[model samples]
Target: MPKISPKLAICIVYVAAMMMDGLDATIVGPALLAIGGALGVSPAATNMVEVSFLVSFALVIPAAGWLADRFGTRRVFLGALAVFTLASGLCGAATTAGGLVAARVLQGLAGGMLAPVGMAMLFRSFPPEERLGVSRFLMLPTTLAPALGPILGGFLTDHLSWRWVFWINLPLGLATVLFGLLALPEHVEEDAGRFDLRGFALATPGLGLLMFALGEGAARGWGDPLVLGAGLLGACLLALLIPAELRSPAPMLDLRLLADAPFRSAALVAVLASGGLLGMLYVFPLMYQDALGATALDAGLTVFPESLGLMLATAAIGWSFPRLGARRVMALGLLGAAAAFVLMSRVAPGTSPWAVRALLLAVGFFLGHAVLAVQTVVFDTIADEAMGRASSLLSVLRQIGGAAGVAASAAVLAASGGAGLGAYQAALLASVAFLGGALLFALQIRPAPAPQLRAEAEPSV
Candidate 1:
């Protein structure tokens, strides 16, 4: 077992921050119906508030890392935590829907930095062997967050009031800020590099417009000129962003990292896999509660077994990575996730919720294995000097992947023209196909000896 150090203390703090961010995210799921009931608005579309959180989060992830590189990690991270806490209070205090949404946007921006920044600190603190352990340890929040979300959110919503869901983050959020200040080291590198303004202009609008099109298309109709224009313009702009990234010095994101075989294959796999899983997160929660007549707490708990599976698989992968190498372990993960997908496609309208939970739990374990491997490979292969840039790019890609998944699932709804178990099952089947492709990519990762030094400790911008 790796000894816990001061850095481990910081990782614990990171877990706390992640929990705060995640708790707030799903806390409202239980309350959405209630909110709509009280406000007399359709709850089906209340997703806009939550969706806005994801939108701002996706748009700024690349910038977040670059900012850390130019400024200081400790400063940006601590400030972000403080901002998140303050925003959470605002969110809880909100009486109107618009006020709640605005507060959510602030929370999203603050929360976006938590994962990558925390990761930057962790990778830099320890060597590879210990790094994996910390990474495994970090998995706790990722898995636990979902499970914790509904439980706490439900508790608050059931007993005190739905507003308490956001209020609950206050004390914990402040503690996370204090811990970050005490434990996280100050990396005060004055001169990082030039900002890639052209790249930012291309990527940001491209992503932002694309999401706007996706979210609105369902409501506005596909024949809507606005939707078509947004989608087309976003795609064209994104095409330009890639070429721009290839040419720019100190590019906002380094296209070169995509050149590594493991990194490249993993990037594709991450996109497909993340899209499937995250989309499932959006779907199953609403499906069970809304369609199947489950309670908010019941719905949250149903798909949440996946988190436990994820935490367990993450720990196992860390132990196995040294013995099996990254590729083999990743392949193992894919195969397990694929099995869970197969079972998911077989789900019927009346299938047992408990059964569904069990299958999802199994899927999450394998999914975590794949997620951690992709993260390790990206950090492993990128040039040492561009760690911050690489971190941001990875963050952006995951969001893009998640957004694409959500959009694709939304399209499934469009074709079937219904929001029933059938639509949910079709989405699950699509997710299965995505994982099938990722399974092949996992096999292509070339096995090599584990590194002696930590990838994060290597020189970074």
Candidate 2:
């Protein structure tokens, strides 16, 4: 057998970590009903399983960069894997809804660190100019994991136990640890500074509160005091976190990165893309089930073609990015995504399911192109030293964007007071508006000039 390149191995590790995050996020959706039934909880109360995970995940993300810097990427990654694996086991064994929610919170805390830490490792392993190769690894998890999550969840729930979903993570997590121990390189910062306690105090709870408010806003009323107060308090804390970090000698998040033109534009693209994609993820299941009256399994299968479209576009981007320039390709992707949303917005109650599926498939293709293009180009502007914090910031923004998308889309649905199809359409139109704004940001993403590579430490596996 041919030897695997060290860089390739690292990229594979990163993709695997991302896949875990994606799979967990999507897989639980299908199992919610089963879990509620098994636990003898009301559907409203059971939704807290997902909510707990999201809140805990958001709380830990800002700390990921700091931990990776304080320790080493390898150590942090391994630790995260351990936490996630053990928590998955606990989640599978839970007997009560509260117990399950607690286990999931632990799982989310661990999962929170995986993606950003893995990203810091990958970006540091590859030079900026050469980072386009990272896309080959990223595309699969980004495109397929969520798309496959519901299908796999449905299959497991129907054929086996819902507990199998959590059980499934065990072997994968163990293998990841073994491979990582052998192959993943340790990257430590030169001046590993003190823990930013004040910054952490502000940012952590701030983001957590904000995510909770946004996440729960639609489910509960936005006007609810919990939602209103948390939103206000979180916003204030986050606003204060900015100057606190900028003034601190060693910042956790490095908010200064946003000052860079390329990074800022790319960050905007990340936020917008996440918002739109997550919004669709929220809406499509409703469209299939509530609007069209399909079964859970059928709804999941209907969305499966989207993965095919994403894979096709991602494969094509590897060829097209270098030839056509990232900017043009990304612009085209934004427009394509906007078009897909436009089509989806016009979908009537009686519209053929196949027609709706085709539009979703198209959204996957176009959005895939947009996601790959921006992720590839963004790293070209980041230096090795700052990659950790930048990766964490991007991850945080993506999560926030997703949470906001779910909230905003849900609000729109609630406002329509549902004659079924009309609510979904209005929600989709809101997504289209988000895409249009994202396109404007895409237009501003100028091509980053190739970076000047320097000789330093190179990894040998």
Candidate 3:
């Protein structure tokens, strides 16, 4: 009989954890309306309950390094899964929007550790030739979650109750934790050096101020004084955080690593390119429901194929990356996505939903590398000691990019007088343009020579 490898076992835990991560992000979207009705709150209140999770997830990412260093990746991840499971179940019990929002915050805190830590482990342990295999395998759960979340969450919300959305996490989390206990390997980590209290203070308010501004702008209008003040404060905080990291004894993000051109370029490109990808997602469902007059089930059904396309793309690229070279592979993906967005821009009243689904499927197919290759480049440049910090920075950047993308696109469309299908069409066109630019930038990343690829990339975390 053949023996199961340790890497394979770890991959199992990775898949379970990532599937839940994507599931958590999308599960709320389908249930948000049901939750509003159940709690007798306005749609906006219920939406905040969802935003509360994103905020917590973004805010905690920078600190994941500190926590992981003090506790070790394996221990922190298991603890996080337990916390997420317990909190999700409690969310199922809540009768009020506030209660659900509070519970989601707990889940977010727990979840913040899982993705970055897992990425660190894979980066540290896998041989370079094996990364695409690991990335492809891990990508499956993420791909399935969104496509599944709406279908499943929508079904449960419609047939069961919205609370079941939270209830669903309990069994999944428990199984992952239990299975991981026996399968996930342990890596010993050193004691924390000096704590970067200043760095934490900087990043916390830096990201928090920006997110608060964007979220408030979403509901209250960007012209409001509060939003303007918050934006100003956020920009200043970030300006301070960059210099502070350069000077700190224990910088949270390790700005020095920016010396590596490939890693630095990839990170910046991610910040730029990811905007339209997530923004369109934020825009599309609203377009369907508010303007196009589609039912919840119809909207989800139309979108599921897109998620499937993305999952399939991730798997294909992971299998092909070693042979194609990361630069050529990623550029082709972005270029394909750019074409998809251009197709979406042509939508008008009575435009075929079949065509729309085809466009979305194409978009998802190429977006697999936003995380997959970005992290691969980052891990290639940094050493083991910096793995935790590097992963945290990458995760935080991705969140910021998504939020910024959605808000910026919406702002443009709104300012253009909300002019029927023209506005929607224009916004989609802009998104395509953005992705095309990302493709240009992606072509610049240099893959590691086969001889230079690390045997154990990000081992200790």
Candidate 4:
């Protein structure tokens, strides 16, 4: 057997952990009805399973960086992976809705740590310019897993049991944990400082409540008192959190990173672009199944082309980034993605599935270009010592963006009366508007210097 380099081993471990995380996040969707049925819960009550995960996931994200820095990346990541696997077992074995929700909370807490810490490890393993080479590792975990989730979930629910959805994570998660233990290197930042209790106290509940409000508002009406109360309270806390974090000697989120132009631009572009893409994912299935009367399987299959396009585009990015520079690539990508959304906005109930598939392919291809560029450039200037906090902050922002996207899309659909081709079309156009905003930011990105690009292109000694 060929010896695995440390970098290759790190990539494998990160990809495995993230793939499981992504799969777990979306896999529960298709099994919700079955899960609710088995647990003897009302459909409305069943939503708690997902909401619990989202809130807990939001709550733990701000703490991930500190834990990784204070302890060690390998330890935190492997521990999280092990806990996530154990939680998956608990979820599968649950006899009641409350039990299931509790297990999911554990799952979310652990799941939240996997991404940022693993991301930090992955990026730290490669130089800034050479980071593009790891794009393939990213594609499976980020794009393919989410795209495959509904399909896999639906299949498991139909053929076997809803419990299988969570159970499936067991082998995958356990294998990852074992491999990670053997292969992953440990790193701790000496300057990580004491825990940012003040920042954590303020940011944690604030983000949790905000995520709760966003998730509930999309499901329940925005006018619901719970939604209103949570949203207002969350917003107020977060408002106070900003200044508090800035003044703190060791902030949990490190908002000061935004002062760096490349990081700021990349972060903003990530939020907008991911919001649009995720919003489209949320809306497209509903449009297909409800408005167009397609089956769940058909909807999932139609959406699969997007992942295919993303994989192809990501494979090409390793070649493209050194030649075009990040700025031009991002701009062109945003432009193309916006155009694809514009085309998709015109999709009607009468439209052919193949036509929709082709458009989604374009959307995914363009988004691959934009997202990979953002990822490659985000940490270019960030010191290794700060990579943990930077990754945490970016993860939090992207999560918020994703929730906002789903909420905004839901709001648009609700405004248009929720059950027509026109409503879905309007919702999609909302995503296009987001892509346009991302384009504006993408244009602002300053490309790396020519010398750096040349260095990135040359073969390593």
Model number with the top lDDT:
4
Would you list the clashing residue pairs of candidate 3? Answer: 123-458, 124-457, 124-458, 124-459, 310-364
Residue pairs with backbone atoms closer than 3 Å in model 4 (clashes): none
- Give the winner by TM-score: 1 or 2: 1
lDDT of prediction 4: 0.77
List, residue by residue over 162-186, the lDDT tens digit for candidate 4.
8999999999888888887777788
lDDT of 2 at 392: 72
- Name the lDDT of candidate 3: 0.69
What is the clash count of model 1?
0
Enumerate residue pairs that collide in model 1. none
Q: What is the C-alpha lDDT profile of model 3 across 185-279, one tens digit per residue?
A: 77746865667788878877777677667655645678999989998999899999898999887777778777777777787667666676766
lDDT by residue (tens digit), candidate 1, 1-461: 33446676777777888778766656676665555455444433444456657766766677776677788888888888899899989987877776876787788888888777777777777887787667656765654665677666656666677778788888998877877666667775677667778987987778777876775565566779999999899989999988899988777778877877766787777777877776666655666655567776776676667767776765576576677777776788778887887687676668987898898788878788777776666566667876666666666776667766666665565455446767666766666666777778878877779733223321100
Evaluate residue 357 in candidate 2 and report its C-alpha lDDT on the 0 to 100 scale. Answer: 79
Kindly give the stretch of ten consecutive residues in candidate 2 with the minimal lDDT sum: 452-461
Per-candidate Cα lDDT values, in order, are 0.70, 0.75, 0.69, 0.77
Q: Against the true structure, candidate 1 has what lDDT?
A: 0.70
For all candidates, what are the clash counts?
Answer: 0, 0, 5, 0
Task: For residue 326, give model 3's deviation from the true position in Å.
Answer: 4.8
lDDT of 4 at 351: 88
